[model samples]
Target: MSSVAKVVRSARGLLLRGSFKQAATQLRADISTGPQQQHGTFYEFRTYDIKPDHLSAFLKLTDDNIQLRTAHSELVGYWTVEHGGLNQVFHIWKYDSYAQRTAVRAALAKDHDWMSKYISKMMPMLNSQDSEVNYLVPWCKLGKPPKQGVYELVSFQMKPGGPAVWGPAFQAAINTHDSPGYAQLIGVFHSEFGDLNKVNVVWWYESPDKRAEMRHRAHGDARVVAAVRESVTYLVSQNNKLLIPTAFSPLN
Candidate 1:
């Protein structure tokens, strides 16, 4: 099987395990960033399952309409899943405020050309039945971009009653850490997608060695251990990729 297939399969496996704490820990390790950096009110972890023939059309639409016209948020880095999952596309968009999100959606909806050309092109390829939009809970600190490196992206789908218990432990872990590669922790508000029981956290690493250092820290961190033990119910999906900013976007 192809490497992409392996990744998709691994993500699916994590999802199937349904352990929120495990997922959160895994996701923290997977966090990485792209070129376009903006903090504050980052929204939407939009995932799509596009049809093969329509993939090109979808990319073109995203490139032109969503990427080009949307002014509310900058287009950050994104990853195209090729292997384990079935025709998946994942990307992150940053927004300044709730009002901006609303305005951008309205504007996009009214764009006749975008709706007619791009949306129409994507209609056939989209698996509307299983697609998801989850609110993002940012975990990285805000500032100038860090040096380039590989980062892991892991997300936790908290169980209905897990956050209250898990949140403190997670926060404590962040507070106690003094690791070298650990950067910033930002909270994200996910809007317009997914169930309410989920909270997503992203971690940033300066390098692979730093990422490994954090993982080693996690092993001995009492707070992290406690949190994981308390909120054991959740789903986790992980993706590791190099952060690459959009060549044409303002984020660069």
Candidate 2:
């Protein structure tokens, strides 16, 4: 067998032995052994509810003054909800560590340009806001699509035990669709803050119609159905949002 096949076999054996944690531990160890991604990176998901009438102004202000805020930290992506939520903007920020995030927050508070040009003008346009910190799942890396396209954010609230309990099957279900060459799997993130035991799966497609076609194709596949059936047992609730990348979004 090829080296890749051997690795897959080993991973399957570990999972069969009910060692999801052990499998992840070993994979992480192997990653640390090579020149790979840093382990402590965090992604903060921020959602702001914009006043309906001020939505356009909010987007414009953000497009114009976002650089000041981004100078403190990295912006992964910024988007507006097209469905599942209205008049809301969502953005992801990347930080190397919690300390880095704290420092960025402090710096943002002090930056006159960010506060005055962006925050001050942008504040009144919001109804409320929310944030959640998440870490990329051990077995996957963030992915880019074939080209710029619409994205979907699917949030799954799982039962109490966190990734240790649901992660294997959940990842397996995601992989079934991915391996079948369906919609692009952007990333799978496990919540680190806010609501516990939540996982977010991000996907990209050429368009809404393409996404529907891909979903239909996946549902027709027996492997996809089986994997989803297993994963669904751990799911408590789920929600999804269709996102359109903002003009200045890194992922746009």
Candidate 3:
């Protein structure tokens, strides 16, 4: 867990003592200091649409050359969309700040190994690339699960009002997931740039069988059912992707 997560947990304990205002004040104060003041670490979520016939080839190229990129920074997670966007490879890269991202790209630009052996050849294989930057929500942070597991990324596109419109209900929904141990919450991130109302929560499972069993049991869970019913009213659309971690992915 990150420092932000620790602070949130501490504040949450105070709320039980009729100190909600104090907790909120402390949380606000925390957010305004250090990295939180400037949005802490950032994530680059990039989706690459590949040519149908070129998908396999493109993936091969990616697996083969990803080291060139990871050498400069971190590849948080990577996957191909299975349920929502077709033939798309979605991945997240982490950086300390925008300045680090810029410096890393500059390093890649100067590396002949990356330019000649990969970039030039890989560009034509992609149809389009969409990118966005996001920040982790205060109560959520990056996670590291076992290296071998099934991963799921659930993205919620909320109504225009953002977190304020649905935070309480959504938080209630998250609480239910915790008690049942339905899945391990890898992280929850909210869009900072690009489409503004998007939020994504990533989860991991021990196995496919485990995930199926959990969902089947969760379907009958009343607390989860109730919280989800209330949260849907503030959502525009939702997407889920079952991801298989790449060999080089940090989150794997």
Per-residue lDDT of candidate 3, residues 93-181 (tens digit): 88898889999999999999999989998999989999999888777768778657878888899887556556666767877886579
Worst 10 residues of 1 by lDDT: 28-37
Off by over 4 Å in 3: 1-39
Relative to the unseen true structure, what is the C-alpha lDDT of residue 243 in candidate 3, on a scale of 0 to 100? 79
Q: What is the C-alpha local distance difference test score of each model? A: 0.52, 0.87, 0.82
Estimate TM-scores for all models.
0.55, 0.85, 0.80
Give the C-alpha miss distance for residue 155 in model 2, angstroms: 0.3
lDDT, model 2, position 177: 85
Candidate 1, residues 1-252: lDDT per residue as tens digits? Answer: 533335446666787888656655554443322122344455556667778777666666676666435553566545454333556666666667768878888888887876786777777779753424444434444333454443334455554433333444444444554343344433333323566545554445565576677778776767667655544534343333333223343322
Give lDDT tens digits, candidate 2, residues 35-124.
223489989999999999999999988888888888889999999999999999999999999999898899889988888888889999
Q: Model 2: clashing residue pairs?
A: none
- Please identify which of the two predictions, 1 or 2, would achieve the higher lDDT against the true structure: 2
Candidate 3 global CA lDDT score: 0.82
Whose TM-score is higher: candidate 2's or candidate 3's? Answer: 2
Cα distance off (Å), candidate 3, residue 192? 0.9
Displacement of residue 148 (Cα, Å) in model 3 is 1.0
Strongest candidate by TM-score: 2
